[model samples]
Each structure stands twice: as C-alpha cells, then as structure tokens.
Target chain A: MTDQLSLTLAALADPTRRAMLLRLAAGTATVNELGAPFTLSQPAISKHIKVLERAGLISRGRLAQTRPCRLEPGKLLELNDFMDHFRVVTEQQMDQLETYLSELQAKGTEK
Target chain B: MTPAPLTVSRVFKAPIALVWAVHTDPKHQAKWLSPDNPEGYLSKLDFRVGGTHHYGAPGPDGAIMYGTQTFREIVPMKKVVLVQSFADKDGNIAPHPMAPTWPREILSTTDYEDLGNGTTRMAVTWVPFNATTVEEATFEGARAGMQGGWDHQFGQIEAYLAGL
Candidate 1:
C-alpha cells in the first residue's frame, strides 16, 4: 500500500507525466498516438510512460512489436478507499451544520 | 487518449451572492469545505483571477491532504474556472498520499446560477489534466467509487442544508 501510494505520488510529481496519464485514460494509445496532442517527442512521452509503468499504474503490451497502453482500474480502488474517509467526515459535519442552521431559522421566525 | 470530463452539481438554499461568497470567501470556505474532516483547514484564499486557494484536511489515519488551485477565470456570483491539484506545502503537484494512481491535477470549473428566491445552484466539474495512462486510468476506472464519494459528501451537505 505504501509503495503504491508513493509511486502514485512520484508519477504525479511532474505535469508532463500527469498529462500522459490523462491521455492513456481516454483509451490505450501508442507513444506516437499519445504524443500527438502535446506535440511532445515519442521519447519524451515514453519516459513519462516509464514512470507510470514503474508505479504499476499501467502495463504495456506487445502487439506485433507495437506497445499500447490501457487503463488499469485496480489501483483506483485503493485511491477510493483512501479518499473515502474525507467524504464520511464531511457528511457528518454537514448534518451538524444543518441542525445549527435550523435552530437559527427557528429563532429568527420567532422574532 | 483524451481525458473525459467529470462534473458534479449541488443546490443550496441560500442567496446566489451568499453562495458565491461562501465559495470565494476564505473565511466562509474554511467553514464547510472540509465536511469529512471537521478539523480540515483552509490556509489561504485569494479569490480573484490568477489568485490561488490552498486547503488541507486530515485523513482517517491522520495524514494530511493538501490541495491548491489557481484561478483561471472568475465571474462574480456566477462562475469560477480553476486548475486544481493535490500539492505539497510548496504548492507543487504531488501524488495523493493514499492513491498513487489518482490524477496529479484535476481541472475544475465551478458555476453558480441564481434560481432566485434565495436559492443558488452550484456545479463543479473535475477533469483529469496532464495525467499519465495509469493516472487517467485510475480516475476513469473509479467512476463508481467517485460517485459513491460524492454521494456521501453531497448527501452530508444536503442534510446540512435541510436543517437550516
């Protein structure tokens, strides 16, 4: 878990790398395909992909010697779990705020 | 692959200006933006075009979630376009500590429409920006999870408004 978290962080540390990840998310693409939007060189895009590959966020496949990328959904579950706590806490506080607001409204109406 | 855009919206029983104020005002933002972590803090907000917003929340395990956003566009009591990212203390993009696959930067656009009658409808759209295949995959793959997260967070906010 720690490794994946750190790896994810490492991959995100660079903006170019992050854009590469977003490109892959749309669908699997070759280095050439992914580099089209940014006009980055294939080598530069490959370097970014390498970082993601090391992070285990993606895996490259060989199809007639052409490597393509695809989105790996598993790692996101880990992220969802980590972010879940924030959602829970926020909900609880909102409930409390609701009660407080109600009382305030009641007092206002009484006046 | 082109990243798909993600959007979420909520309605609040408050004036449009008040809702806009809450979103743009540092003091008001600090109050409710951290619904999950009651102790979440809003460190700073410079709510203008080119300004920035910085906020943090503690995780269940006590790890901190620090995030920042630079305002790209701002329309008073109406709309805000910003580039947001999880960041370290220095305001540099950082991977989410818990999810290595999450996107580094999420471009978000928030719009507030006045429905009149003291009601404001707010919408926030989040899109993965400058992400890698894994990062993008991580975000796209977790649609259900993201929905669930928003359900809880927004539900809480709805409840909070109901009481008012």
Candidate 2:
C-alpha cells in the first residue's frame, strides 16, 4: 500500500497529470479526449496515462481500437491512509508535551 | 458536527515581506512546507488570484503525498485564500479515500500581519465546504490531531529558518 501511495504521489506531482486525474474522475476517456484541453498530442496524453497506470492510480482497457483509461479509487485510499499516520504521530507527541509542561509548572510551584 | 474551522497560527521573527515571500515562492515553499514530507517538492505554482499550485513530497515511509490548491483571493503581504484538494493522476480533484467522511474540498485562508520588530504573524484557517454528513464529522473528529500535525510542521519551519 505504501509502495502504491509513493507511486501515486510521484505520478500526481505534475500539473498536467493532476489535470488528467480531474478529468478521469468525471468519467473514463480515451487518450485523445484527455489531450484536448491541454492541446497536447494523443501520444503525449498516452504517456501521462502510462505514468498513472504505473502508479496503479489508473488502468487502461481496450475499447475497440482505442485504449480508454479509468480511475481506480483504491490506490487513493492507500495514500490517504499513509497521510493519516502523521496525524497519529503528531497527537502522541502533543500528549507527551502537555504532560511535560504540567510537570514543569508543578515543579515551579513546589519551589 | 461541523468542525470549528481548523487553524494553525505562527509568529515568525521575519519581516512580513520575507515571510510572505517564503509562503508564496514555490522554491522557498518547498523548503519548509509539509514537514511530514521529507523530500518536499512544489511541482507547479501560480501565485496570482485564481492560480493553482500542485505539490508533491515523499512521506516518512517513502510514499508521495500530493495535493493541489486553487487561489481565489490574493492580497499583497496581507491575505491569501484558496481552495485545496487531493488530486489523482489525471490532475482531477479527488477526495481522501479512507476518510470518505472528509469533505471533498477545503477552503483555506492565510492572513499575514506585520507585527513590527521584524516579525510577521501568520494565521491559516481551513474548513470543509459543501461536505456530506460523514465528511463533516470526519473533519470535526480529526481537528485535534490535525492541529498537532500543523504545530509540528510550524516547529519544523522555525527550525529550518533558524538554521539558514
């Protein structure tokens, strides 16, 4: 899952790729369709789709002669889980900090 | 319950311009933003009103954390408002997968105040927008933990700036 998330993030880093994701989220489309708004060639769009497929964020299936790409929500779930881990670590540290601060106040009062 | 707006405010001993530069410049931002991301990278940044920024960085365990923001308001050295979301491969906006409860979009605002004494006060606020019941609940539930994460991130920025 972590491996998948890293791939997804790396793939999504580019604005072009992120735009592709947005279009795919709306509905599946062919490489040519994805390229239309960006004014890129079909081959260029295909490359982006390939990157996404490698990241497991999307998959391509042949519909007739055209290869249509579809968004796979599962990998996104994996990435979200990875981000949530930070929340856990942060809260634990905060708990420890609060305890230490209270102890400091107590010691000061004792003095 | 709709969560109270989540915020992370920090005071930095730098002039407002310098701090705003750090916040707005993509290269400078990549240096200290998103501390959880060890290899922070800002892929695309459009700093004007209605501009968009796409950012990605390697998480602690080596996964990439990617997010996008669209600028809605921009005021020189004073305020910036934007809408942010997670993006999928096609650059399409997506929601947090695991937190199906999370709002699909977050409205974020950052205000900078010149505090004199070479210091700048920054306050950032985030709130869910047009969220479903689950999303709103998830945001409210995660508030405390999110606050903790932001606190750590601010500390990281302070340290990085101090080291410079």
Candidate 3:
C-alpha cells in the first residue's frame, strides 16, 4: 500500500526527480526545460515527472501547451516532519557523543 | 536505480579510535546512545563479527522501542557494518513499532574517518536489506525525503518550502 508520506518520499528518492523539484522550486518549467540539464531521454524525463506528479510534488500548468510543472509543496510538510524527527534524533545523539567524548578524555588525562 | 541510503555524518572533537570505542564498546554505547532508559541487555554488547547488540531507547514519542544489530563486518577504527532490525523487549526480531511497512532489516554501515588534527568524522549509511517491493519503496521514499532532510545534505528543501 502506498501511503501519502511514502509516495512523497519515493518521488523525492530519485536524484533526477529531486532535482526537478529543486528546479521547479526556483520557478515553473516545461518538461523540456526540466529535462535539459540531464542526459535522460524524453520518455525517462516524463516518467520522472509522472512520479513527482503522482506524489503531488508538482502540478501541470493547465493553460500552456508546453505543460510546465510547478512545485506543489503542501505534501512536503508531511515528509519534513518525518525527516525532522530523524534529524532531531541524530542531533541529540551527536550532542551526547560530544559530552561523552569529553568525559572519556577527561578520564584519560587523569590516568 | 538502487535506492538511496540514509546517511548521517558528523565531525567529532575526539580522535578516531576514541570515537570508535563508543560505538564498539557496549559500555560506551550505553553512555551515548541512551535516550531515556537503556534496558539491561542494551548495555550487554556482544561485540564480534556475527555478534548481536540488542538495544532499546525512547523513540520520538518517548516510549521505548527495541532494536538489534547483528554485526556483519568490523574494521578496527575504520568501519562497522551490521544488519539493523527492530526487536521486541526480549530482543527477538520484530516489525517496526511505528511503521510495519518499514523494512525489517536495514543494512547499516558506519565509517570512522580520522580527519587528522585530532578530530574524527563518523559517517553512517542505512539501506533496507532483504526487503520486499513495498518495503523498498517505503525505504526509497523515506530516503528521498531524508536527502532533503540530509540538508534538513540533499539542501533545497527549505528553500523550496519557502519559495512556495
């Protein structure tokens, strides 16, 4: 079962797709312009685009024939909280690591 | 494409060997890894190739979640690779407490780099191991978000959010 968070995460998983999101973040871009920086073929680019669209990370520009894509970041908050939890844990661990290291060295200096 | 691995890297003020000690020695791990209550077995480390290090710490919501590490490889003062999985309080392998779709086993590799000038850099890489399609997809998705998270290394997420 593809949960919303999972879908968002999976869409962002690909380096190409993530970049596409980043490019879209700067401004909207048609599929062609989005595909310009990489060597991926048109179909491959389209496939990546589809994944992002499916995740709700981006939306198609309805009026334009070129069908530019814009970053739809509403779904990202969900993933952000998840990733934030991860970062907080890792950050806490680092803090502990630093404290413990100091204690270890302090003991070492005593010997 | 092979799914992206969840990675965390940090520079420690201590030397490499000292930094490695905290990870390899149960006593040291108990000291640093403890979030709230570290159970008895959590401190009891079987540090060997093919050894199991069962541990428990408070998850995000402050309830304890159990997990275990089966060491696959160990390079002195350099790297340690293991299979990381969720476990019951008894240390039996179990599904994730929060996300059942979460992969049961994740291949975890941690590298200790001697950054010279009396400092160490610890890098960790995590990827689902022996996972099914859904498991892999979940992991890939988690990792994709983690990249922005990683900046959160992968750094445009904040800007992307702000620009919107």
Candidate 4:
C-alpha cells in the first residue's frame, strides 16, 4: 500500500479533484454541487471524492438526503510541512553561498 | 495541457563568474544542494553535457534515496539544462521513493544573468519532461498549489481551518 503522503499527492494529481477541493475550501458542497462545474457524471465525481476521502483530504457528512463533502485542512498542513522544507533548504543554500563567496573574496584580498 | 513551469529566482552579491563557478563546481554544489541536511553527499558529478550527476543520502527508515541529473546543455557561466530523475545506487532510473506518481523526469533550467557591479540574478525553472497526460496534470496541479492561484486558495483554507 502507498503511504499517506503518496496517497495525498496522488489524490491531488487530478485537476477535477483539485477543482473540487477549491470549491470545498470556500464551503462544503454535495456531490451534485461539486460535479456541477465539470462535465463529469455523478459516478465520476464520486470516484474523485473517494480518492480525496481516502487521502484524508476531505470528509463527507450526511445532511438529510444528501452527503456534503468538507475540506480537511490537516492533510493539507502535512503537505505544507513537506513543501516548506524545500523552501527553507533553498534559503539556507543561498545564505551559505553568499558567505562562501565573501570568504573567497576575503582570501583574494589578503593574497 | 502543459502548465507554466515552476520558477524560483534569487540575486547574489557576487560576480557572474564567481556565481557560475560556485554553482557548477561539485564541491560548492555539495554544500548547498540538499535542503534538509548538509550531510548528504554527491557521489558523482560529471560537469559536461551528456554526463550524469548522482547524489544520495540516508532517508527515513534506513532507506537511502538517490537522485540523478542527466545534463543536456551546459552554457558555461550562463545556463545549465538537465533532465532530473530518481535513481537507484547503481544509477538506474527509479520511481521516487515517497511519491511514485511524481513525474519520472523533470526538465530543469538554471539561468544566470549578469546584474553588473559584481552581482548576478539566478533563476531556476522546472517542468515535467515528456510526461503522460496524468503526470502533466499532476505536475500542473502541484505547481499551482505551490506557487500559483492555489496558493491564495490555500491561505483561505488555512483561515477557514483555523475557524473550525
């Protein structure tokens, strides 16, 4: 089985799924409501929802006869954490490079 | 459809020659390439077109992860373009250890612009290389989420989540 991180990334690999998440970010919506913006069938939308749900990116709740899907921020937080590492790394590299260059220049001046 | 390539840029207070040399030199690359840890080392670096660069370090749970970059173009002191891939210790192409669906290869270009007065502007751009429809969509989605429109939506999501 793929790990949670991999599953989350795979769930987010689709434009339709991402669009659905964007809509949910504003507010919760039913399967029909989520499917309204796209030319997808109910079953197709449901499949995408299942993928998101399995990745723990969205949660479905029952409301009378309809099921509304809400975005779960926790999974996204994990993704943010993963991406932030790269950002930090890049910043650190740039800083180190600056220092390295300064030291190189200092040596040249001393020679 | 192909999406806009992800790009990041920075300006360094150094001459174009110095900046370019630091970037191309393996010794300097080893100092700054890995984001999380400096202990990870580059095993091989062939600084020429048609050559390959390999680096790896111990990953979570005792698994050593490897990265390979096959150089396609090298314009000294100006640009370097390469195809990046995950690889095994033997340097054979492999799926990314964490995200298997991640693009098998990414085309990366690094450009250096002379800013005069001993300063240089560097920009790095990345895009999926000959990706499938699904891979292309995935790359586009990830890039958007990280650096484009989805970035604003993410902020909204963060605020909404905080309210919950």
Candidate 5:
C-alpha cells in the first residue's frame, strides 16, 4: 500500500515520464501526440502514461473517440505541500537557534 | 546514478565558536533539532567522533519515533559530518516510522565558515549513505523533480488552477 507521495515520486523518477508531463503541460494531447517527441513505441508510451494516471499527475478525457491526456494541477499542489515540510523544519530550527544564541549572550553579559 | 545532494545554507548572527558550541552541545541540540513543535526531545547524546546521538518524540498518536546520528568527523568550530538513521526506542537501526522506503542512512556534512564580524555561515549537504539501487534511484528522481522542474511546474499549475 504505497502512499500517494511515494507513488507520485516514483512516477516522476523516470525521465520519459517527466518529458511526457512537460509535453502535457502545454495543453491536452492524444496518445500519439504525447508520444510524438519520444522514439519509444506505442505500448511503451502507454505504460508511462498509465503510471502518470495512477499517480493522479495526469488524467485522460474522453472527447468523442480521442482520449486526450491533461495535467492535473492538484497533484502538483500535493507534491509541493510534501516538499514544504522540509522548508518548515529548516525555518523553525533556525528560529530556535537564534533564540538560543540570544539567551547565551544574555548569560555572558550577566557574568 | 547518485542524486545531487540536498544543500541548505544560512548565516547566523553569532560568532563561529558560539555557533559551533550550540550545534555540538547536547543541551543546546535538544532545544532546536526537533522538527514538529516542542513535543520532541533528545534522549541521548555523546558529543564525540564515533559517538551516537539518539533522540525521539511522541507522534500525534503517542507512538515514539526515534532517530540517531553517529558522528563521523568533528572539526572544532569548523565542520562536522555524521551518518543519520532512524532507530527503535532501544537505539537499534529501524525503518522509518512513516516512510519505510526512506533511505536507512543519510550522510550529512556541515561546514561552518567564519564570515568575520561575529557572524558564521553554515552550509549543510545531505546524501543517501550506503543506499540500495532502488533507494539511490528514488533520491535521484526526487532531486530531479524538485530541483530543476519545480519552478516551471509551479507556474504552470498556478495558471491552470486559476483558469479552473
């Protein structure tokens, strides 16, 4: 039972999948359209697309007969939220260090 | 391939000696190293090379989440390097409580640069230590996604969200 963040990071680990996401960022694209830039075969591209879809990074829309893949901004926001944890930790630690230094200085002044 | 190290740098308004002391002293370490609020505490510390520092705090559900860092190098007032790992309450190495796939150990190197004028610049670098191929790949993927592609994706996502 992989978490959403683990799935998202695993899906993003591949260069080919990242390239597909970059292409989808522009606008919606069909399977062939998404695979146009890559030399990979149809099934290979499909596999990459499936990973992205599973991770909720992209979604496919049924427009008539053509299924167009579009980027899902919500998943990107989730990824951002995950990374922000480290930022918050770093900031909080720095704040605590500042306070500690001030207390040390105050002790030195009293001596 | 190994991923690029995650690096963070900051300048402190204190002297290099004071900054180094605060970082190495277990009493001072207990004051700031905890990530979440003030719920965590450093349970044990040995401020010497080859010594280990074990710390933990109660999780939201009241379970203890422990971590350890073994000192590898200590340069007085200048640098410190350590290998960090998650551990059980008994101080034995254990899988991360939240993310089992997280690397078992991370090598952390911190450099203290004296900028003069009672200020010190601190830079820290973190990399997976003795990781398996899968762990290395995961770290590489995260670094690639976070470092180079984040800003571009953020802009696109913001615009896309605004349009919705």
Candidate 6:
C-alpha cells in the first residue's frame, strides 16, 4: 500500500488542489464553493476532491444536503514536521558547511 | 526487498585532507553545525570506531533536541560509516520528541573522493538501521516527499492558508 505522506505531497503538487486545501483550511467547503475560486468544471473539481480525499488531506462528510470537505490537519502537520527537520538539515547546517569549506580553501591559498 | 539508500552528494573545491579534517574535527564541527546559533546546537565529538558525536539541534518549537552519531567505521579520508540517532543530553538513544515514529537509528556512510583537481566529492548515503516496518516506511516517505524546493512554498502557503 502507498504511504499517506507521499500521497499528500503528490496531491499538494497541484496548484488547484493546493488552493482547494487552503480554502478548506479556513473551514469546510462544498464542491461548488471550492471550485468557485477557479474556472474548473464540477467534474474537474470532483476529480481534485477525490485525489485529496484519497490522500487523506480532506474528508467528506455525509451531510444530507452537501458533502462538505474539511481539511485533515493531521497529515498536513506531519508534512510540516518533516519540513522543520528538513530546514535544520538545510538552512542551519549544509549551507554553512559550504561556506566554511570555501573559506578553508581561501585560507589555504593565503598560507 | 530493501529500499535504496537515500544519498546526497556535494563536491567541494578544497582538497580531500581539509574536507576529511572538517568532517572529523569537533571544533570545526561546532562552528558549522549550527552556524547561526552557536549556543543553540551544541557539538562534542569523540572520533574513533564506536565513539559518538553527541549534539543538540534546535527544534522548531524553540527546544533543543539532542542527537548522537556513533562511528561504526572510520577509514580516514576515504570513508566513514556512522549510526545516527536521537538521544538524551547524556547521549543515550531516545525517541524523537515530535516524531517518535521516525527511524531510531539511521546508518549513514560518508565517502570522500579526491577528484585530482583540488576538489573533494563527498557523498552521504543513509538507510534505516534496525528499524521497524512503520519506521522504515516513515523514512522512505520523508525521503521522497522532501526531495524538492516546493517544500518552502508549501510552508508559506500553509502558514497563510491555516492562519498560523
């Protein structure tokens, strides 16, 4: 079975779906409401919603009138946690290593 | 089946000796380990087979999360194999504070090659060490999901979208 994180990232790679998730993050939205911001058709919006639902980024409620899509904060937070660690590995460390290595090279030239 | 190890490589304009020295030296390590926050991320290394480099990395929540890297093999400037894990201040292996499901020990190999042009190519290959199925899956997902610059945009969009 495919993991949830990989699915979430793939679902997020699309700008339209990212916008849809952003809208849902504010609050739950119906399919029509989600597609209102973009010029996509109902089927197209439904397709994106299906991807988000399958990825567990959003959940569809069985409300009688409209099945609203609510953001699943858990998966998104997991991605965020990964990003935080990624930042430490990148911003806090490797860039500095590069600079230090270059400085050592320069110092060796001066010696 | 074993998944392919995640490898990250970089080539530096310095010689292999300097590159290897920086990798093994504690003083040099403390300098760049957290270049912006010297006092935040602490580094103390005992470089030898089975020796450990215990350090604290600043967490996202403003806490210092400690980690330890134990040397499994040190082949001088050619290669160094280490087991990396989260740890307590005393350097005992521990679960990650925020991500407990993350691999407890990651075996990594760092190889330094002299390109004969006064440049050194360093490659670090990482794999989960003695990890559970879930832990291995976690590492695999993290490795694949994070291999992009889109992560930054995701953060920014999340911040604005979530109003956090």
Best by TM-score: 5
Error of 4 at A69 (Å): 1.9
Candidate 3 lDDT score relative to the true structure: 0.78
Docking quality (DockQ) for each candidate: 0.07, 0.02, 0.44, 0.37, 0.42, 0.22
Q: Which tens-of-lDDT digit does each residue in B1-164 have in candidate 5? A: 67678777789888999999887776676666653445466478887899998887554465666888999999998899999888988888896544455578989999999999999998888899998765665566566655665646656656766687
Candidate 5 lDDT, A6-107, residue by residue in tens: 678778878888888877777889999999988999999999999999989999997877789999988777767656654544555677787778778888
lDDT of 6 by residue, A1-111 (tens): 345665665576566887787677678888889999888888898999999899888898999778888887788887787667665674446567879888877887799
Name model 3 segments beyond 4 Å from true.
A36-42, A64-68, A89-91, A107-111, B1-11, B15-17, B35-44, B75-79, B92-102, B112-121, B133-157
The models' CA-based lDDT, in order, is 0.64, 0.66, 0.78, 0.78, 0.77, 0.77
| Per-residue accuracy of model 1 over B2-96 as CA lDDT, tens digit each | 65566666666666766666566655545554545554664777777899887776645677778889999988887788988889876677776
Which residue pairs in candidate 6 have backbone atoms (N, alpha carbon, C) closer than 3 angstroms, thus clashing?
none
Q: What tens-digit string does per-residue lDDT give for candidate 4 at A1-111?
A: 356666676677677888888889889898889999998888898899999999999999977778889998888888777566545434556776777777777888899
Worst 10 residues of 3 chain B by lDDT: B35-44
In candidate 1, residue B24 scores what lDDT? 68
**lDDT winner, 1 or 5:** 5
Backbone N/Cα/C clashes per model: 17, 14, 4, 0, 0, 0
Task: Identify the runs in model 5 with alpha carbons over 4 angstroms from their true place.
Answer: A1-3, A22-26, A32-47, A64-66, A73-77, A106-111, B34-40, B57-65, B149-152, B158-164
Residue B25's lDDT in candidate 2: 78
Chain B TM-score against the true chain B, candidate 2: 0.79
Q: Distance from true position, residue A44, model 4, in Å? A: 8.2
Clashing pairs in 3: A9-B141, A10-B141, B149-B152, B150-B153
By summed lDDT, the worst window of 10 consecutive residues in model 1 chain B runs over B153-162
User: What are the chain A TM-scores of the candidates, in order?
Assistant: 0.70, 0.70, 0.84, 0.81, 0.76, 0.81
